[model samples]
Target chain A: MKFGFLMREIGQGLSRNVSMIVSIILVTFLSLTFVGTAGLLQAQIGQMKTYWYDKAQVAIYLCTDTSPADACPQGEASSDVKATVEAALKDAALTPFVERYYFEDHQAAYDKFQEQFADNAVAKYVKKEQLNETYWVKVKDPNKSAVIVESFTGVAGVEEVRDQRSYLDQIFSILNAASIAAVGIAAIMLASAVLLISTTIRLSAFSRRREIGIMRLVGASNFYIQLPFILEGVVAATIGSVLASGAVVAIVVFFVQGYLAQRLPLTSFVGVDDALLLMPLIIGSGVVLAAIASGFAIRRYLKI
Target chain B: MISFSNVTKQHKGAPKPALDAVSLEIERGDFVFLVGASGSGKSTLLRLMLREEIASRGDLFVLGQNLVTIPSRKVPALRRKMGVVFQDFRLLPNKTVFQNVAFSLEVIGKSSAYIADAVPEVLRLVGLEEKADRLPNELSGGEQQRVALARAIVNKPDLLLADEPTGNLDPATSAGIVSLLEKINQNGTTIVMATHDVGIVDRLKRRVIELRGGVIVRDDKKSGYETALPITDQVPISSDTEPEQGNEPEQANEPEQGNEPESRISSTDQAEEQE
Candidate 1:
C-alpha cells in the first residue's frame, strides 16, 4: 500500500519479464499505429471530398474543323449548332440538374493550348480553328454526373463528355480500401497484444504465488496483493501506446506535411493538428485494454 | 482466542474426514501443543484455526469471527491479527532478512517510520540483528528460520500458529527456536504449535491435545508430547512408537550444535563451498 514499496514491486516485476513486456509494447504499438494510420487516411479522404467535390465538372466538347472524334461528323461547329446545343442544356428537365455553365471557344482553347504546350511541335502545327469549343458544367449534385454525361455524350456537335468527378471517386475508393486493410490488420495485432498482456500478468502471478500466500497469511488486502501484476500490464501497454502516438505524430509532421504535401499539391491532406486529436483515443485504448486484460487474468489465475 | 464446537472437515472424495466432531477451547493466552502422528489431524486442526479451510460441519471461531460466515473480503483483516510459521520457512529468497520482516508490516499499510522501528526490533528479538542484511540463502538453516520467525512476529499479532517450526533443524537449533516462541508467548501472544518433534513438547510441559483419525482422544493440562493416556489403553503403544521413528532421523542429521567455534567454522566452510 505504501507508494514506495508498491513502485519497487512494480519495477521489479517489469524487469523480471522484460522480454514479455517488450513484446506487449511492440504489439500494442503496431496495432494502435495501424489504427492511427487508418484514421488519418480516412481524414485525408474527407478533406479531399470537401475540397474537390464543389469544383467537379462535366466538360462537353464541341466539334472543330479538324476534330479527330467520331461524334464530330461536321467539319466545324456552326453558330447555329452551338445555339441548338446551348438550348438543349438549358431545357426544363436538364436545367434543374445544372448549377451553372461556361463556354470555351476555339480562340480561348488555342490560347490555353499554346500556354500549356508552347514548345511542342503539335502546337506549332495547330491553328485556332482546329481547337475544340468546350462547355464546362457545374452540377447541383456531383454524384449526378452520370446523368449529364449519358444525356449529352452522342449528341450532335459533341466530341465527348468528360466527368472529372469519376476520376476523384476512383482515387477515394482506393484510399478507402487501404484504410479497411489497415483496420483488419490492427484487429489481429490488437488480439495478440491483449493475449500477451494477460499472459504476462498470469505468469507474474504464478511465479509470485509463494510471496502472495505469505502476504495473504499476514493480512495483506486483496488489492495490495494483486497491484503489482496489474500494474505490469498497464505499464507495458501504456508504453506501447506512447510509442505508437509518437509514430503517428512523426508521420503527420514529417511524411504527410513535410514530404507528401509538397509533392501532391492537387489535393488537401490531414495535418498534424488532426493527427494530434487521435492521441487521447490511442492512449485510452492502451489503458483500457490493459486494465481489462489484467483484471480478467487476476480473476482467473490469482483467485483473489 | 480460538474455539471449535463439534467441527468436522471432509476432504472431497477422501475416505476419512480430516477432522470430525472435534470440540475444544483455547483461551486468550493458552500455549497449546497440537500433538499427533501423520494423518492424525494435527495439521488439519491448525489449518482450521487459520481459516485456510472451513469446518464442513459445526461452528469454528478464531479471534471472535465465525470461520464459515465471515465474508471472503474480510479474511485478510482477520488473518492479520495472527502470525503463522511453516516448516519451509517461506522467506522471500531475494529479500534480505530485514526486508523480509519489514514485508509483513508493509502488507498491512504500516507507515515507513513504524516499519523502520518495528523491523529491527523483531530482528533483534530473533537474535539476527547482525545478519539483517543477509539474504535467506546466505543464512544457515536455524538463522533462516529465525528470519521467518521475525517476519511472522513483526506485525505483533495476538495469536502465533506454527506448523512444524523446527521440523528441519537439529535438536539444539530446535531448542533455540522453541525458546524464541516461548519468549513471544510470555509477551501475551497465544501460541498454537503443531509439531511431531516430541523432545521440545515434553520439555515445555504445556497443554497437549492429541488427535487420532479426526477425533480428540486426549486433551491434557500441563502435559508432555506423549498423550496423557492410561497405560492400559492402546495410546501408549502408539506414543512409544513415534519417538523411535521420528527422533532417529533427527539425531542422524543433527548438524553441529550451539554457537561454538566448531559450528561457526563449518557454516563458513559451507558458504565458501556454495560460492
Candidate 2:
C-alpha cells in the first residue's frame, strides 16, 4: 500500500461526508461517556465498600437510667452488670471473633450525639444520664458481626446489639442499583453508536462508488480498496473517544474529587487516576468497533 | 491469447443463453472485432474474457491460464495482465490528464518514481502529453478517450478489451481512437473491440466475428461490417474445426473454480464540469 495514496484517499472521503462524520463522532462521544461513567461508578462503589466495611463495628448498647423496669429492674445498668457484660465479651467464645474493642461512657455518647445533631432541636433537651454506655467492637471480618450479635443479645443490662453494616448495606444496595442502571444505559448507547457508525460508512461508500469501481478494475486488492474507508471511521471514532475521556476526567476532577469528596469526607470516592485508567479501554474499543462496522458496510461494494 | 472451446454462458432467469456452444481462437497480437446489435452477446463475450462472468459449461483459457477453474483470489493477477476500456471515457472528472493515467498504476501499488516516468510516456503515446494538466471536461471527446487509452495501457497489458470504446465518439473522432487502438495492437498487444460502428469497422477491414442471438455466425480474417447478404441476418454456425494455432502448448497446472455475476456498475467519474 502507498502510504501517501491511502492518506489522500482517506482525507478526501472524510471531506466528502463531513456532516455524517460529525454525527458519528458525537454519537460515539455520548456513548463512550456513558460507558466511562458506568466503569467509574463501579470503581467508586468498590472504593466505598472497602472504606466503609473496614470501619464497620458491632455496637453493644447498655441500659440507661430511663430503661424499662421489666428489662432493667434496677432502673439503670449497675456496676455488677457492667462487669459481667465485659467478662462475657472477653470469653473464649467471643474472643475469637473480636479484632479489637473500645468503650464509650454515657458522657462520651452524649458528646457524640450533640456533635452529630448539633443543629437539631432535640439535642438541647438530651442529658448525659439518659444516654447508653456502649461497647464498640471491631470484628476480624465485618461479615462475621453475627457472631457477636448472638452472644450478647438479651443478656442482662444489654439494650440492643446492632451491626453498623446493616445500615451501610442499604446504601450500598442503592449504589449498586445505580451503577447497574448506568451499565444498562451504556449498553443501549454503544449499540446505537455501532449502528450509526455502520450507516455513516454505508453513505460514505455509496458516495465513492465511482472511485471504488475504478480501483477494483485496476486490480487493487480488496484490502487496498477498503483501507481508506475503514480508516475514516476509525479516525472519527477516536476523536469521540478522546473527547469522552476528557469528559470523564472533568467529572472526576470537578464532580467527584472536588465536590463529592468535600461533601462526604468519611467515605473515599473514585479519583482522577481511576478515570485516567479507563482512557485506553474507551479509546481502543471505539477504534476497534468502528473498524469492524465500516469493514462490514463496505463489503457489498467490494465484489471482487 | 484467448481460447473459448464450446463455451456456453446462460444467465439465470434469462430466456436463452447469451453465448451458446461457441468455439473460437484469438492468437497473440491479433486484433479481432466483435460486431453485434444490443443484447446480441457481444458484451457477454467481452465479460467472459474478463472473467467477470463464468461460463455455465465448457472450457475457456486466457494468457495460458484456464479461466474456467481460476480461483477468485487469482482473478486480480489475471486482470492485471489485461486492460479494459468502456464506451464512456470513465475518466475521473476531478483529476487532470496526468493523474488520470497515473491512477491505474497507483491502484496497483506502483511507486511514485515509476508512475512519474510511465505516466508521461503513455501520455505521449496517446497524444495527450500537452494536456497533462487539463481535466477530463476540458478535453474533447476524442482527447478524453485518448487519456482513457493511455490509462488502460500504462502497465503494458498483454491484452486490451474495448467495449464500444467508440460508441460515444463522432465518426472523425472514432476513426482517431480506432487508429490509436491499431497502433497499440501493432505494438504486440492483443486487441478485442466490440462495436456496431459499421463505417469504422468496414474501414479497418480487420478480422470480424459477428454474433446474433448468442451464437457466432461469421469469422473472417479480412472482413467488413456487413456481408453481401442482409445486414439483419440471424444464423448459428456449427462449431468450427479450425486447426488450433500451434504457437504454445497448454501448461499443466492446478484447476480452480469461481463464479461471479457480471458487473454493470455505473460510474459518474466522467461527469462534465464547467471550466
Candidate 3:
C-alpha cells in the first residue's frame, strides 16, 4: 500500500527486463503510428471528397463549325439543334439530376482555351470558329453523374459527355486501398503489441513471484501484489503510445501539412489539429490494450 | 483464540480426509504444539486456520472469525491479525535483515517513520539487531528464522502460527527457536506451532495435540512424548474432558478469549507515530 514501495517495484521490474519492455514499447509505437496514419488518410479522403467533389462537373461539349464528330453531321450544330439540346436538359425526366447548368459559347470557349495555351505555337492556328461550345452541368450527386452522361451523350450537337467523378473514382480508389493497407499493418502490429505486453507482465510476475509469495504470506492484499506488474506493462505501452503520437503529429505537420501541402496546392491534406485530435484514440488504445493484456497475464501467471 | 467444531478437511483424490471431524480449542497466550508424522494433517490444520483452505465440512473459528463463512476477499485483513512462519524461513533473498523486517510494515501501509522505529525494535526482540543489515543468505539457518520471526511479530500480532519453524535448523538451533516461541507466548501472544521435533516437545511440556491418520489421537493439558507412537485405542474423540494415558501434568494457565488484533494494530500505528 505504500506508493513509494509499489513505484520502486515497478521500476525494478522494468529495469530487470529492459529488452522485453523496449520491444513492447516499440511494437505499440509502430501499431499506433499505423493507426494514426490510417486515421489521417481517412481524414484526407473526407477533405478531398468535399474539395474535389464539389468542383467535379459533367462537361457536355456542343459541336462547332469545324467539328468532325458524327453527332455534328451538319459540319456545325445548327442553332435549332442547340436549342433542342438545351430543352432536353430541362426536361422533367432529366431535370431532377441536374443541380444547375451553364452554357459556354464558342467564342468564350475559344478565348479560355487561347489564354490557357497562350505560349503554345499552335495557338495562332486555333480560331474562334473551331472551338466547341459546352454546357457545364453540376449534378446533385457526383456519384450519379453517369445518369446525366448517359442522358446527353448521343444528343444531336453534343460532341461528348465527360463526368469528372470518373477521375475522382480512380483517385479515391487508390487512396482507399492505401488506407486499407495502413489499417491492415496496424491490426497486425496491434496484436503483436498486445502479445508483447502480456509477455512482459508474465515474465516480470514470474521473476518477482518469490517476493509475491512473501507478500501473500505476510498478509498483503491481491491488488497490492498485482499493481507493480500491471504498472510495468502500462508504463511501456504509454511510452510507446506517446512515441506513436509524436510520429503521427510529425507526419501530419511536417509531411502532410508542410511538404505535401506546398507540393500539391490543389490537394487538401490533414492538418496538425486533426492529428492532435486522433492522439486521444491512439493513447487510449495503448492504455486499454495494456490493461487488458496485463489483466489476463496476471490472472494466468499469478495465484493472487 | 481458535476453535474447530467438527472440522473435516478432505482432499479430492487423497485416500482420506486430512482432518476428520476433530474439535479443537486453543486460547490466547497458549503455547501449543501440533505433533504428528509426515502425513498426519499438521500443515493442513495450520493452513485451515490461516484461511488458506476452508474447512471441508465443519466450522472453524480463528481469531473469532468463522473460517467457513468469512469472505475470501477479506482473508488478507484477517491474516494480518496473526503471523505465520514457515520451514523455509521465507525471507526476501535480496533484502538485508533490517529491510526484510521493515518490508512487512511497509506492505500493510505503515508509514516510513513507523517502519523505521518498529523494524529495529523487532530485530532487537529477536536478538538480531546486530545482524539487521545482513542478507538472509549470509546468516545461518537459525538467524534467518529469527529474522523471519521478527518480520512476523513486528506488527504485534495476537497469535502466531508456525508450520515447522525449526525444521531446517539443528537440535540446538531448534531449541533456541522454541525458546523464542515460549518468550513470545509469555508476552501474551498465542503460538500454534506444528512440528515433528520430539525433543523440543518433550522438553517444553506444553499443551500437545497429537494427530494420527487424520484424527486427534490425544489432546493433553500438558504432554510429552519421546517419539511418535500410534495409540488411537487409548484416547477416543468423545473424551474431550477425559485425560489420555500420559504423564500429563496438572496446569492452571488459561488465556482470555476475544482479544481483537485490529485494535492492537491501530494502537501500534499510533505508537509508531507518537515515537
Candidate 4:
C-alpha cells in the first residue's frame, strides 16, 4: 500500500472523528505542558544553585570592643588575634579547600557597616575602634562549607562562623518538593493522554468497521488496516506538542521574563530561551507517546 | 470448485448444529442456488465457505484450500479468490462507487496504474460506469447492490457467493440481479446464491439445493424451470399438475425409507430430480 494513501486515510479518519481528535489533542497538550513545566522548573533550580553556590562564602567575624560578653571572653579581638585568624585560614592543610581569603580590619569593617546601614542610628554609634574585624573565606566547594565552618568554630580568635549554604538549603528543599510534585502530575497526565488517544483510536476503528471488513475480504494486510489509526494518533500528538511548546515558551517569556525577571532578577529563573531549548525533547516525547498509545490500541481492537 | 464432506457447524450456545453432516460438491462454472427457509443454515453454509465460520466437524474445501485448517492470518488471501455479497450490501458509506470498487485492488497492493485500469473495467462490467463518482447513499437499492457486485468481481474472483443478494429488491429487480450473477457464472466464475426468492430460482432453472432443518434434503440441476409466485401473491398452484407431482407420489409411498422428513420431501424430491 502507498504511504500517501495511508496518510490520506488517516487524515480522513481524524477529520471525520473531530471530537475524538480534539480530546486527544487536549489530553496530550495538558500532559506535555506538565512535563515541559517540570523540565523548566528543574533548569531554574539548577540556575539558582549555580548562582547562589558560586557567591556563597563563610563569614568569620572576630570579637570587637563593642561585642557582647557572650561573643568575646575579654574585650575586642586584638590585632594579634585577628592576624593569627588570617594566618590560620592560609594554612597548607586547608589550602585545597579554600579558594581565597580576605580580611576586614576594624576600620574597614566600620566603613562597610556604615555603607550597609547608612540610614540606621547604629551607624553613628559604630566607630572604627568599636567595630569587629572579620575574615571572609571563599571555598572551592560550597557544598562542603560545613566542614570549613566546623574547623573555624572553636579556633583561637574566631568569634563566629557561618556558612551561607544552610540558608539556601531551605529554598532548595522547597524547589525539590515542587519538582517532585510536577513530575507526579506529569506522569498522571501522560497516562491520561495515552488512555484518551487509545479510546479515540478505538472509536475511530469502530466507526470504520465496515470498511475494515471489506478491506479484510480484499486481502488487505493487518498493518494496512491499522496504519491510518496510528497516523491519526501521531498527528494529534504532534499538534498537541507544538501547542504545548508554544504555551511553555509564552509562559516563560511573558510571565517569567517580563514579571519575575524584573521583580527578582537575583533568583535566576528559567527564561524563554531555556524552555525553548527543550522543544525537541517535548516534541519527541509527544510523537513517541502517540505512536505507542495507538500501536497498543490497534493491536487490541483491530485483529485483521 | 467447492466441496463439503460431512461438514457440521455448531454456533456458540446453540442447542443444535447450524449445519448437520452436510455433504455436497459444487463444480466450477456452475451457478448453484441454496434454498431454505429461515434458520435452515443457508447463511451458515455460505459463511463456512468464506471461512467466516469454520466447520465444527469434517472437511470443507474451497479453491483447493482446506478451510477447516486454514489459519486466520491467511483467510484474507483465500478470500481474494472468492467474491461474497451480503443482504445489506456492506459498502463504505464514505467512499464513492469508484473508490469502493478500487478498494479491492488497493488492499491487494495493486499499483496505481493497475488500479486505474482495473477499477473502470469492473465498473463497466457491472454496467455502472456512469455512477462511479456517486456515494452509496446517492444510489438506489439496486444500484448499490450493483456497486457491491462490481467491487466483489473487480479482482476477478474464482467463485462468487451471494447471500440474499436481492432480498430487498422487487421481483423485477431480483430477476435482473440473478441474470447478472448468471452472466458472471457463464464467464467461468462459479456462483452459489442463497435466496428466499423462489421466483428467480425457478426461472433460472440452474442447480438448486433445498435445505430444510439444517440438512441438504435435495439437490437439482435442470432447465425449463417452474416459476413460483412470491408468497405475498397467494396464488397457489394446484398439486395435480405441479412439476414435482411424479416425485411427490413416489416419495409419499416410501416416506419412511429416506433420512429426510416427510414435510421436506416434496421440495427436496423435485430438486433432486432436477439435479
Best by DockQ: 1
Instruction: Give a tens-digit lDDT track for model 3, residues B98-144.
Output: 99988888777789999889998888889999998898999999999
lDDT tens digits, residue span A231-254, model 2: 999999999999998999999999
What is the per-residue lDDT of model 2 for residues B146-209, given as tens digits with 9 covering 90 to 100?
9999988999999999998977776667777888999999999999999766666666789999
**Backbone clashes, each candidate:** 0, 1, 0, 4
Report lDDT (Cα) of residue B55, candidate 4. Answer: 96
Model 4 bad stretches (over 4 Å):
A60-94, A104-108, A120-135, A149-161, A265-272, B1-8, B20-30, B54-61, B64-72, B93-95, B135-138, B202-275
Estimate the TM-score for candidate 1. Answer: 0.80
Candidates' C-alpha lDDT: 0.84, 0.83, 0.83, 0.80
The C-alpha TM-scores of every prediction are 0.80, 0.84, 0.84, 0.79
lDDT of 1 by residue, B95-212 (tens): 9999888888898899989988998888889999999899999998899999988888888889999998887876667778888999999999999998766667767789988776
Model 2 CA deviation exceeding 4 Å by range = A60-97, A103-108, A124-134, A143-161, B228-275
**DockQ-based class of model 3:** acceptable
True contacts kept of each: 0.85, 0.48, 0.61, 0.57
Q: Is candidate 3 or candidate 4 better by lDDT?
A: 3
Question: What lDDT would candidate 1 get against the real structure?
Answer: 0.84
DockQ of candidate 1 against the true complex:
0.58
**What's the fnat for candidate 4, on a 0 to 1 scale?**
0.57
Instruction: Evaluate residue A79 in candidate 4 and report its C-alpha lDDT on the 0 to 100 scale.
Output: 73
lDDT of 1 at B266: 49
